[model samples]
Target: MQRIFITGTAGFIGFHLARLLLDEGFTVAGFDGMTDYYDVRLKQRRHQMLLQSPGFRATEAILEDRDALDGAIDAFAPDVIIHLAAQAGVRYSLENPRAYIDANVVGSFNVMEAARRQGVAHLMMASTSSVYGAETAMPYVETQKADTQMTIYAATKKATESMGHAYAHLYDLPTTMFRFFTVYGPWGRPDMALYKFVDAILDGRPIDIYNHGEMYRDFTYVGDLVRGIRLLMDAVPVRPADPADIAPGDSLSPVAPHRVVNIGNSTSVRLLDFVEAIEEVLGVKAQRNLMAMQPGDVPATWADASLLQSLTGYRPQTDLRDGVQRFVDWYRAYKDSGGLR
Candidate 1:
């Protein structure tokens, strides 16, 4: 069995991805800080579920602690490393810019150093659609220029991409950066819109609808997003022999074994339509609190995942209504079990 070291197994994406990989018969070593960004109970619950699998082992520690991170990675000595832990919230970054710099910048450097030392076959890290800041083009593609990141969170992720490219170029490390769209489904983050919308609607409270419910998002389901990551794990980039050898539409760097891929549903759904799906699933009309867009938030986002498809031969096809229903079902069950009140 191939051994894999994954950071942030307690996080929403990391939890789901670890489970999927474990089911596929991979040995996974998870690292997480279990921070109280949302609810530590929720994070603990995710880790507990993963522990049921004998293939899963975890260390509870923050990424900023280089010793802890290096210790875990050295002991595991994984064949591949997936760095997913980061201070993740666009709006929160506006409040605490230093947090992003610490976790995303400094902590990421630690991961890269570990990967370089371990000489892992591949290193995959998470980026976000937010990196496509200030771009109004339809269906954002991987090869597009994305320098204008409006939020600290997006800027930090962009910085990581640059850092990863430099490391790959220097060390010949095969690195892949996945630019994820708005992901949703069971075990989603509490700070996300879907979670907040469901919580407030079910409680008969007003739900905040930013951008007056006019925003558009390529809300890739959590399952689909993780599946994309799994497939891309095998689609590792290699340093191109020549700049012209890189395929058209490919984001591969000519000088390094590095590339950026967008994992998304590829279909943009209106914010109101998404809420309607939730309302329909819950059978409750939400008290809408329409408001102006939040700072550092884009009015719309869409992903052109053609590169992902050409590489992995898979695309995210989960319907918004179906995904919403699944989340609502999970939310209700979780609440009934006293996981949340």
Candidate 2:
């Protein structure tokens, strides 16, 4: 069985990914800081469930703690390392810019260093579509120049991408940076729009519709996103003998065994349309508070997942309505169990 070390195993994406891997008989060691960003109970609930798996073991520590991080990695000695833990919120980045620098930038550096020392076969980390800030292109591609970052959150994630490239070039570590679109599903983060909207609607509170509900997003379901990640794990990139050998849309670096892939639903859905699906799922009407665009937020995000499909022979195809319904069901159960508090 493959041994994998994953950061943020207590997080929304990490929890789901770990579950999938464990179900496949892979041994997973998880690391998480358990920050009080949202609800610590929620994070704990996730970890508690993962602990049920005999193959799952975890270390509770912040990514900023170099000693703890290095120690855990060395102990696990995993064949693959997936770094998914970060202070993740676009608007919150405005309130606490330092958090992003500490978690996304500094934390990611520590992981890269550990990967270098361990000589891991592959190092995969999470990047975001927010990195494609200020670009109005419909279906953002991996090869596009993503230099204009709107917020400190995006800037930090973009910084990680650069750092990963440099480490791959220097150490010959096979690295893959995933540019995830707006990911949502069951066990979603409370700070995310879907979770907030669902909770507020259920509680008879007004839901804030940013950008006057005109925004668009390529809301990739968590299941599809993780599946894309699983496939990419096997499709490791290699430094091409010649740059011309790479495909037209490939983002493979000519100087290193590094590449950036976009994982998202190819279709972009309007914000209002998404909310409508949520309302339909829960059988409740949301009191909408149309608000102006918040700082450090984009009006829309669409992903060109062609590279991901070409590499993995799979694409994220879950319909928004079906995915929202699943989340609503899970939310009801969680709320009834007093897990939402």
Candidate 3:
């Protein structure tokens, strides 16, 4: 069994990914900051569940604390390091721009440094589709020029991608950077749209519909997203001797063993349709509060996941209504069991 060290195991996607890896009989070491960004209790619940697996152990520390992070990584001596911990939120970046810089920029540098020092076989980091900012192209592809980032959040993530490429070139570190779309499922963040909408609707509060219900997102299920990550673990990129030998539509860097892949459902669902799916699941009508587009908000985001499929022979195709129903069920059960109390 390979030893895998993962950061942010207390987070939404991290929790799910850790659980999946544990089930596959991998020895896993998890690190998390357990910040009170939303609710520490929810984060605790995620880690608590993972602890049930005897193959799992975790360290609680922020990524900004380089000593702690390095200690945990050094102790694990992992074959692979999946860097998932970061200050994550698009809207919140506007309120605390420095937080994004501290965690996403400086903290990411620490992880890269550790990976290079450890000589890990592979280093995987999470990026976001928001990096494709100001590009009007439909179905965002990895080969497209992603220059015009609109928000601090997107800019920081883009910076990490560039940094990862540089490290891959200089250190010969095999690296994969994933650009994830709107990921949702059970045990999701309270700040996300599906979670907030379900909670507000259940409480009989009006739900905010930004852009007057004119938004679209490539809502990738958490399960599908993590499976993509797992498969890509084996598809490590190798530096191409000749740039012309590279396959078409692949984002692999010619000068480095690094690549960027977008993990998404490949379909853009309208925001209104998503809300209606939630309403149908709950059998409750949402008191809709239409609002103008918030700053740093995009009207639509769709992913071209062909490269992901070609690389891994898999694609994320979970149905929106089915995924929404799963989340609703989990939400009801969690609330009944005294969640958020």
Q: Each candidate's TM vs. the true structure?
A: 0.99, 0.99, 0.99
Tens digits of per-residue lDDT for model 1, 37-75: 899999999999999999999999999999999999999
Compared with the true structure, the alpha-carbon lDDT of candidate 3 equals 0.95
Tens digit of per-residue lDDT, candidate 2, span 1-341: 29999999999999999999999999999999999998999999999999999999999999999999999999999999999999999989999999999999999999999999999999999999999999998789999999999999999999999999999999899999999999999999999999999999999999999989999999999999999988999988898889989889999999999999999999899999999999898889999999999988899999999999999999999999999988888998998989942
Model 3 per-residue lDDT at 155: 98
Query: Model 1 TM-score?
Result: 0.99
Candidate 3: which pairs clash?
none
After the best TM-score superposition of candidate 2, give how far the Cα of residue 283 lies from its true spot, in angstroms. 1.5
Candidate 1 CA-lDDT value: 0.94
The window of 10 residues in a row where model 1 has the poorest summed lDDT is: 332-341
RMSD of each: 1.2, 1.1, 1.1
List runs of model 3 lying over 4 Å from the truth. none
